[model samples]
Target: MKFALAQINTTTEVADNLEKVRTYTRDAAEAGARFVVFPEATMSAFGSGLRTIAEEHMESWRSALSELAVETGITVVVGEFATTADKVINLLAVYSPSGERSDYAKIHLYDAFGFKESDTVEAGEEPVLFTVDGEDIGLALCYDIRFPKLFAELSRRGARLTVVAASWGAGPRKAEQWEILARARALDSNMFIAALGQADPEVTGVAVPKKGPTGVGHSLVSDPLGKVLNSLDGAERLEIVELDLSAADTAAETVPVLTNAKLGY
Candidate 1:
C-alpha cells in the first residue's frame, strides 16, 4: 500500500487548516496514495487552549474530513482534539474511504521540556487499531512515540503498520531524538512506522510561550528493517512511500525478535 505523510503548517484558523487538508488530500489521492496521515493538531492550533476550540468545532471538523475522504477516495488519519465531560483529549481521527470514522485519543501526554500538556488534556486508556487493505494499522499520538511498550502491544495485536501524528516541540536535539525513536520502534516491533510532524512558523504563534519555535517537521516513513524509506526536511510538504504488507512478516522471520521478546518482571 502507498501512504502519504503530510507535513503542514497548521494555524489557529480552522477553516484555513481544513482547506489545506482538502488540498493535500487531493494531491495525495492524485498521486495514488491510499492513505494520508497528517500531523497532530492539524484541525486546530496546538497549545492554544484546544479544549475550547474542540468543543466549538468538533462536528464541523469531522464532517469536513469525512466528506474529503469520501470525495477523494482515500483514507485519512489526521490529528484533532475532542472535549470530554471532564477535559479535552488529543485525538487521531481516521476517516476511511467508505466514510466510516474512528479515532484514537492520545495515551501519553507531553509533560517534559517545560511543557505541561496534562494541565488541559486528559490521557486515553486504550490503543486503537484498524484494518486497511488487509493490513492492521495502529494509531498513536506524538508523545506516545517515546514509549516502546505501546508499539509492542500493537505489534502483538497483529499491526503491520503504526501511524503516529505529532506536534513535536523543537529544541536542543529534539529532531535527532524523533528520528532515533521512530527507527527504534519500527525495529523493535518489526512494523512499518510513519511518524508525521507539524511544521514550524505556523505553530510559532501558538499560545505557548516558548524560547524558540515549537515544531521541527521532519516527517518520515520507516520500513520494518528500521530503514528510512522516505523523509522530509524542515518544510511543509507531502511524501509518499509504498509499503509491502508482507515485509513485516519477512522481517519477523529473519529477525525473530518479536517471537524472542520476553518481559522482565
Candidate 2:
C-alpha cells in the first residue's frame, strides 16, 4: 500500500486547518495513495496555549473528514485537540473510506524538553491498533515515538505499520533525534514506521501574523530493516511511498528480535 505523509502548518483556527487538510487529501488521493497521515495538532496550534475545539466543532470536523475520506476513497489519519470535561485531549482520528471513524488519544504526553504537556493534557491508557485493507496499523503520537516498548507492544499486537503524528519542536539536535528514534523503533519492532511532523513558521493564531520557521518538519518512512524509504525536510509537502508488508515478515524471520526477546508481560 502507498501512504502519503502530509507535512503542513497548523494554526489555532479549525476552519483554516481543515482547508489545508482537504487540499492535501485530494492531492494525495489523486497520486494513488491509499492512506494519508497528517501531523499532530493539525486542528490547533501546538504550544503552551493550545486551544480545544468545542463539542459541536469537533463533530463538524469529524463530518468533514469523513466526507473527505468517502470522496477520495482513501483512509486519513488526522490529529486534533479534543475538549474533555477537565482538559483537552490530544487525539488522532482515523477515517476510513467507508466513513467509519476511530479515535486514539495520545498515550505519552510531551512533558520533556522544557515543555510540560501533562499539565494540560490527559494521557491515554490504551494503544490504538486498527486494520485497513488487510494491514494492521498502530497509532502513536509525538513523544510516544521515543518509547520503544510501545512500538514493541504494537508489533506484538500484529501491527505491520506504525504511524506517528508529531509536532516536534526545533532545537539543537532535535531533527537528528527524530530520525534516530523513528529508525530505531522500526528496526526494533520489525515494522514499517511512518513519522509525520508539523512544518515551521507555525501559524500562531487566526489574528496573529505568521512568523519565520520554528517547527521541525522532517516527515519520513522507514522499512523494517531501518532503511529510510523517503523523507521530507524544511518544507510543507506531500511525500508518498509504497510499503510492502511482506518485507516486514521477511525482516522478522531474519532478525527474530521479537521472538528472541523474552518479556515478563
In order, how many clashes per candidate? 0, 1
In order, what is each prediction's RMSD in angstroms?
2.4, 2.8
lDDT of candidate 2 over 1-265, digit per residue (tens): 8879998877767799899999999999999998999988887766544543544477788889999999999999999777767778889989999989998999998878777888778899899987778888999999999988899989999998999998787788999999999999999999999999887553322332233123587788999999998888767889888877889999999997888887742
Residue pairs in candidate 2 whose N, alpha carbon or C atoms collide under 3 angstroms: 201-213
**Cα lDDT for residue 230, model 2?**
88
- Give the range of the ten consecutive residues with the poorest summed lDDT in model 1: 204-213
Show where candidate 2 strays beyond 4 Å: 48-56, 202-214, 263-265
Local error of candidate 1 at 217, Å?
Answer: 1.0
Clashing pairs in 1: none
> By lDDT, who's the top model here?
1
What lDDT does candidate 2 reach at residue 155?
Answer: 93
**TM-score result, candidate 1:** 0.93
What local lDDT score does residue 219 receive in model 2, on the 0 to 100 scale? 81
* lDDT against the true structure, each candidate: 0.85, 0.84
